[model samples]
Target: MSVRVFVVGIGSGDPGHLTGEAVAALNAVDVFLVADKRAATRDLVTLRAELCAAVITHDRYRFVEVPDPERGPDAERDSTAYAGAVRDWHTERARRHAEAVTREVGDDGTVGLLVWGDPSLYDSTLRVVETIGDLLGAEGVTLEVTVVPGISSVSLLAARHRVALNRVGRPVHITTGRRLVGEYDDALGDVVVMLDGDLACAGLVETHPDLEIFWGAQLGLYDEALVRGPLREVLPEIRRRRDAVRAARGWVMDTYLLRPGTGR
Candidate 1:
């Protein structure tokens, strides 16, 4: 018996953010694999409960903490080591997830994984699935896959800030904070950066201090916070707030967008 998989994105941390179809698919899955950075971040579980809205109980819900492959034993906060370590970690996680699927699904069930945001976005759940699929195929296990889309950090950021993704007729660039730091490029339209470890804006500011940045933290939830202004002025406050919230809550998932000075 082969196992099929469905990966659902839970969207930031809000159960309400889940689309109707996503909720239906989530409830129908035979096994739900939840990947949390730490078991402490119960946001996914909580979101499930909230979205279900009727005291739903999943006999097959399995919470798996993948230990964020991005941070390893020497995982420094947002360091290069952290990045590489995560790649290695995800490889391991996919292997373990494959094992879990084999056991629980018994080679004939649908295993579902709830991703934090849109799977097509920065979320690595898809990559994990790919790795696991390859391993399973090598081991002579067949598999099929499906991905349920959910709101992304960028969409949530735009909603929280009450701003449109792009101006009237402008194109938008969506990239990571690291990329922004590495390449000091600007857009004539709008620029949105995600997966930023609090470095993109700062890096942009040293050279283009006047660039306007709209930052949002924990978007779509009650603890949500947002800041907007010139990068130089808002960068420090964003860092402070980002740090303070992470320390206070033990985890954070944020997304921000930087718009070049088009005087709009």
Candidate 2:
């Protein structure tokens, strides 16, 4: 049995972010693997459903809800433990996806996995598909993978702020909140941080008072909010607003860019 998988990037929470290529891919899919992990992120599942409903005109496509793997305390303690936990989690997820593909989709049929933002940026759907292929290949299941790109949160953040991601000919360093704690250096040019549940920018601002920050939460959504100014001046308000928004909505997906400069 041959299975074809389309890892489609649906962009950041907004249906309008879907590209022409993504819409075409949606029409080609027979099954959509939706991840339902936590109550806080249930809205993300709903948004994917809405995207399908809005773009997919055929009734041939169906959704298969997959329970995501849990990343426990191992992900919080250290880098080694965190990497191991993530690897284990992805392996488990690949097993689940392989079963779903073989049972839910017919031979030669195409399956879709709706990824938030572009698959190339901080998303793991492509890696999961590769794992699924490896697992299923032993059972005589051949796999073909296709990636459809969509607007990334990084692009949306820059557009919303009306600023370039880099400074002149300098490079843009993209990293996570945890890494920013120890790896951050002003000499690294402009830095963009994501997956920051801890508000690392608040702490960094204390040391680098001249740094400027452009922060956005729930980018491209109706409740999207952006804050920008000197890190020292805006960090407190960003924290307050982020907390209030998260409390009201149960979750928040935010990204920020930190540059070494004074506020305009």
Candidate 3:
């Protein structure tokens, strides 16, 4: 019998974000592989369990914890170090994930990985699952994977801000916080930035002072925070509010769109 894995996107932070398909997948799961990330992410894991309780009709399913590996302090400071750390971490996670599957579930059992936001985005769960599949192949077992899509933080940001992501006929550039400055261009029209823990736009305050920004933090959560206005005028407020939300909630996820020529 083949192993079944469902990669379900649960959307950003809200149980209400689960679609009908995601709900169905939740019920189908026999075991949910949850990552015990860190102290700051404890709430995140709780949120998943809460989501499952709120959605699934049966209590037969259970969670199996995958002890996540640390990437080291310097991983965030340097690009090369960060890449290396992430690769090593994923390799280790794959091993642990495979071991957990082998020990807990039978070959025909169903596993669910609840991913935050869309799997096709910056998330690595899909890639890690691919590695898990390879490892399971040793026992002549194959994985039958199913993916259920969820709304991304970028989509939630645009919805909350009530703005179109792009201007009339122009394309919007999507990039991470680290690469935004280099990718920022008037030709791109609207640039959507994500995975930016440092508020990288702050660096563009002087150079692109008049640029309009529609920013949202913890999108869809009860305490969601949003900032909109000139990049220079509202940036400090964004940073302050962002820090406050992170302090109160142990973590924060934010995304923004940079528009040229004043508020599109």
Q: Residue pairs in steric clash, candidate 1?
A: 69-86, 70-86
Error of 3 at 208 (Å): 1.5
Please write out the lDDT profile of model 3 over residues 152-190, one tens digit for every residue: 998898998888898788898899998887667777779
Model 1, C-alpha of 180: deviation from truth (Å): 1.1
Model 1 misplacement above 4 A: 39-70, 73-86, 262-264
List the pairs of residues colliding in candidate 3. Answer: none
After the best TM-score superposition of candidate 2, give how far the Cα of residue 189 lies from its true spot, in angstroms.
Answer: 0.5
Each model's lDDT: 0.73, 0.88, 0.88
lDDT of 1 by residue, 1-264 (tens): 688787887786466777877877776777666555566566556675555453235665544443343344542336676677778888988887877766667657777777667899877778889999998888788888888899888888887788898888888887777666665565546778777665556756668766888888888777788898877777778888898878877777777777776665
Per-residue lDDT of 145-210 in model 2, one digit per residue for the tens? 899998999999999999999988999999998889698888889999999997887778667878
Q: What are the TM-scores, per candidate, against the unseen true structure? A: 0.84, 0.97, 0.95
Off by over 4 Å in 2: none
Query: What is the lDDT for 209 in model 3?
Result: 70
Q: Give candidate 2's error at residue 24 in angstroms.
A: 0.3
